[model samples]
Target: MKQSLLEVKGLRVAFGDKEVVHGIDFQIDQGEKLALVGESGSGKTVTALSLLRLAQNADVTGVANFAGEEGGAARDLLALPESKLRGIRGKEIAMIFQEPMTALNALYPVGDQIAEVLELHQALSARAAHEAAVQLLADTGIPEPARRARAFPHQLSGGQRQRAMIAMALACRPRLLLADEPTTALDVTVRAQILDLLTDLQRRYGMAVLLITHDLNLVRRFADRVAVMENGHLIEHGAVATVFDAPRHPYTRKLIDSRPQRDVAPVTARQAEPVLAAKSLRVIYPVPRPGFAGWFRKGEFVAVRGADFRIAPGETLGVVGESGSGKSTLALAALGLLKHQGELDVAGRRWNAGGASDRALRRVMQVVFQDPFSSLSPRMTVEQIVGEGLTVHAPELDAAARRTRSLDVLGQVGLTEAQFPALLDRYPHEFSGGQRQRLAVARALIVDPKLLVLDEPTSALDVTIQKQVLGLLQRLQRERGLSYLLITHDVEVIRAMAHQVIVMKDGAILESGPVGQVLDAPGHPYTQKLVAAALAD
Candidate 1:
């Protein structure tokens, strides 16, 4: 039998007095891919970080044995001397962090960063290491690697930055890779590409990977074995097929069953005039053409072209597509944020009417942005944030009235002074991600908008929290008879929330039909691919 590459036993992690991870045991065979699956704060991350002795401000104990080094004695990473561990870190075991934009150095070129790893571990000169860096990027299926190598972290796309991160982690040809939610921030197509890249590279290097992620679909596609964690305790571990097919632990079952569920009320008032309507809507942008210094003569890029859609008074019209598929542009056009060359109206009034009328009409349609923490002002209190809309939309209401209205809407979104002490005076940063999203909904709903545009509302959240938020939105829609212009790439989310759905690709609407019909039997090839790429694990 092959020797285990890593054997972790009695692993425990704590932050001060609170122990996040309890004693747990697991092992990975040579070239095996094992996934540590759980939601946020599950201690999977700290477990991996503890192996490398990288967990900060926390006490980590127990044994993490590594046998990656050839002809050398196996080392207990938790007990290894700092100096010796540093030598073995990038050489034998390397890590690919979750967020590449923050994980990578913004000041230096991606190639230089990758080369730095080679210089430290492989003892390669700067020039040779840099050349190797470009090759590694190309191996990861990045186009024009030499050019992309020179670009900074922010300059590259999400997928490219992740690939570059992978290249740097593999620069020293480590025997084990610790990847933490590597594709969480990426689109489905890009996430698939990165998984394929990792699979290929892992086979080539004969490396074992400890993948720490909450995405079960990714685990199904990539991992050979799985370990489930809950509230920092390892509850179950087994072959991927066995565990996923028939989860023994209730927590594992809960995680698997947490896929978005459809509970939305069917549209019975389809004949009613739509809260929002658009026909032949087109949004075009001017860009500088390549070569000949065409800055003087720009090229035209059509972001959304000839789109037609309508959301009934109490129905949802979902726009589904991948990144750069013009879904968001269509959303912007619907919101009256972008100029369009077509017939579009909100509550029977055309956009860009100018002055008080336009501002007042805009209140009929409100938007809940993707990221709530960023969308909400940090300095403002919860009452201030939610009631700010009332100031503009209902100026006649005094401060007391605004506060009353704010509390009412907040209650609709599931926030209450009962749960959160001094809730009104609290700031945005104090709330959890799911709670923050709820606050965003309350802010949009306060003005009593007829149409709510939910833009990837739950994508940033994990499955459990995502389920909660989707439930909240579903309840809100049913109770208030709210019309929604939901823009998202998540097929499950569309199935759960939308009544009517439109599939878009490259600024063109490829298919339009009911959510059940489009999802269950996709006519378009692109739509089929998107649905197929959903959460199968």
Candidate 2:
């Protein structure tokens, strides 16, 4: 067997008085890829962070032995001094965090940030470090590396920012790379590209990878071995294929089987009226003109160009695309939140630019945003959140009636007073991600809307929770006859929730048809590529 690059024995972590990660053991061999898979709150991330002692306010114990370079003496990372640990951090071991936007320094240029790592760890000259940063960016498939190097973290797209983070992590050529849900926030195509880049770089540098993620598809595609974690325990560990093919643990099997399922039966008749309809819709924003032309006229950036689609009552229409593809713009237009140039009708009424009619239209159309944690107010209680829509649509109702309505709606979304005694008084932060998303759904449903615009509704959820939420949505649609305009980058979500589908790219529709036709046998090259990438993962 190959020599172990890093080995952990009886690891444990506790935050304050709560023990989060119990004693667990695993090892990564030289130049190998190991995936730690689990759902949120399963202690996957906590376990990884314990290796580097990065989790704040947490107490860590047990041995994390790392084989030093050139057959030097192996060091117990858990017992290392802070001074020595600092030396080993970026040089001997590096980490790529989950969210690049927050992980990177917003005030500094991304290139300078990478250069700083090289200077600290590799002790290179300023000029040499800067040059190396640019080269590293280019190696990670970033375009216009020199120009991009000078750009701040906010200036780059999500994919570009992630590439910059990767460049910084690899600057010192560490022996082990700790990637924590590295592609979780990325678009599907960008995710595939990042995975390919990591795989290529791992092969070239001959480094071991400890990938922490809940995405089983990613583990199947990228990892050589898999270690399954569930509620702070190591439930299973073996070769990737062996564990995936014959998972001994129920949690592991559940994770592998958690792919979204299509439960909404096809509508046979066309009896219901269209809840939303759009014809040749166009949305444009005025961008600053570059060069001398800025003195005269602003440039027109078309966000949604002549897109046409419709959603009937109780039917679901999915819009799939990458970031900056204008799918969210279309959702905004459909919700009457944005001004558009073509014919867009909701509940047989057109948007009236914040007039009395527009206020009425708001009652007929409600939206559930992508991230429930941010979308839901932290200061607001569950009762306040679910009942706020009633203030606008049913202002005449008394406080007691509003409370009753809120409770009823909450029950409809699978939350009840029986489940939690203080359900209404609880805040968003008090709930888990899945519970928060259900609350978001309840808030949207409380308005008695005919149509719901779901923007990446399940993108932020774990696979199992995603399945549950989709099931809730399906049940709600079937029972309430509500229509949905689902916007997301996940093909599985689209397949599970949508009856009809439209594939978008660069503010234009490349393909539109029944979900079966569009996704299974996509005619457009872009759609084909998307399908292939989803299947590959």
Candidate 3:
């Protein structure tokens, strides 16, 4: 029989006078992949962090018995001395955070970061540690591992950086791994690759794993056993297949069924003129060349390669691609934020490079950014933030009129004074993520824009919250006949919200057609690969 690698009993976490995580129990068998799944604020992440005594300002109490790496005597992690726990961390047990950019040191090369782990845990010399770091990166499937080892965190792409993080985490061949939302920030194909790599590494190293995430599709893909949490409570747990097939808890069932579904209207005839149109549109950037050429001239990099598309009134055109694929560049060009070649028109009028005449079209095109918190001003109140657009598009409106329009628009996006007393007075940080996004949408709507550029609008939201926001957008579109240029990497979202879809890769459109046709029967191999990845998830 397989022995339990780690077992927890009566785990409780508190911050000052307020307790967040109630008592909970769970166990991971040796070489097992156990997933702790829940939405934001479910205490899943806190529970895992507290197990390692890494949660700052947190008081953790529990019995976390961890078997030694070589199957020797077990120790209570919760009761271990800080010095002893440090020895265990990154050696007997390690962690991979959700965002590699923040977790990885920006100043040092990723190789040094991995080498640092090896030096601390394995007691290896600097030279030996550095050599081993390159090997580790290679094992994680990074290309040109030796060269990549010298590159800093920001220099590497998202997937490459994440792979480096995994290599560092696994450097000492830990007995157990705690991965907190490891693939949440990754693209679909990259997410699948990471999961597969982790599975292979776990089998090779014979290490048990605790996967913490809000994504159920990932849990289904990666876990053997599943434990669901809700608002700091452990709601249910069982084998992955058993729980998914017959979820006993309401929250568990809801999560399982929360994958975005096609809820918008079908693609209709494009009889009307397109609100936004672009033909053979291209965007380029200049980069300094190394050595001799750099002194005199710079080389050019094409961001968007002759892209052509359109979005009629009440229609949605989704542009899906991986990071650095230039979907964002196309959106920027469409928004008149970039210089582009070829013909591009908004409402049958061209952008005169930010001329006063372009201001007229700006009112017809407003955008909702990906991260609402960062995009929104922290110092600005809801009234100011939402009404700021009005000053540009509707300058005739006074403060009182602007405030009234802001409140009405907010109410339209599902925010109201009844729900949030003095809603206009609150700042961005004062609201939840979903509420903040609602404010962003309300801000755009207050200008009475005919089109919206949604740049991964729900990518930062929780699953249920994503559904709510998408529903709200769909409702508003149906009522207001709004056109949307939706930019995202989520195929499920594209399937749900978009009428027309374009698959982009390396700054070029690989496929373009109705969502049903492209998603259901993709003609391009890359599109097929994307569709397959989404299906696997």
Q: Using TM-score as the measure, which candidate wins?
A: 2
Task: Give one digit per residue, the lDDT tens place, for model 1 in 1-537.
Answer: 867999999999988899989999999988999999987667888899899988888899899889946757788999989998999788889998876776899999999999999988888988999999999999876778988898898667555787888888888878999998777655676677778878887899888899998778788889999999988889999999999999999889888889888898888888877788888999998765678978579988798989988888889999888766788778878888888899998988899878987898779999997768668999999999999999999999999999999999998888999999899999997777678999999999999899999887886676888898999988888888999999887787898889999999889999999988999999999888888877442
lDDT over C-alpha atoms for residue 521 of model 3: 91
Q: In candidate 1, which residue pairs clash? A: none
Per-model TM-score versus the true fold: 0.84, 0.89, 0.87
How far in Å is the alpha carbon of 345 misplaced in model 3?
A: 2.2
Q: What is the lDDT of candidate 2?
A: 0.88
Q: How accurate locally is residue 136 in candidate 2, as Cα lDDT from 0 to 100?
A: 95
- Lowest lDDT 10-residue stretch of candidate 3: 260-269
After superposition, candidate 3 runs with Cα above 4 Å error: 71-75, 80-84, 100-168, 266-269, 355-360, 377-384, 391-402, 425-432
Error of 2 at 525 (Å): 2.0
Candidate 2 — worst ten consecutive residues by lDDT sum? 265-274
Per-residue accuracy of model 3 over 261-324 as CA lDDT, tens digit each: 6667654548778898999999998865778979999999898999989888889999998766
Angstrom error of the Cα, residue 49, model 3: value is 2.8
Runs off by more than 4 Å, candidate 1: 50-56, 73-173, 354-358, 373-384, 391-404, 425-431, 535-537
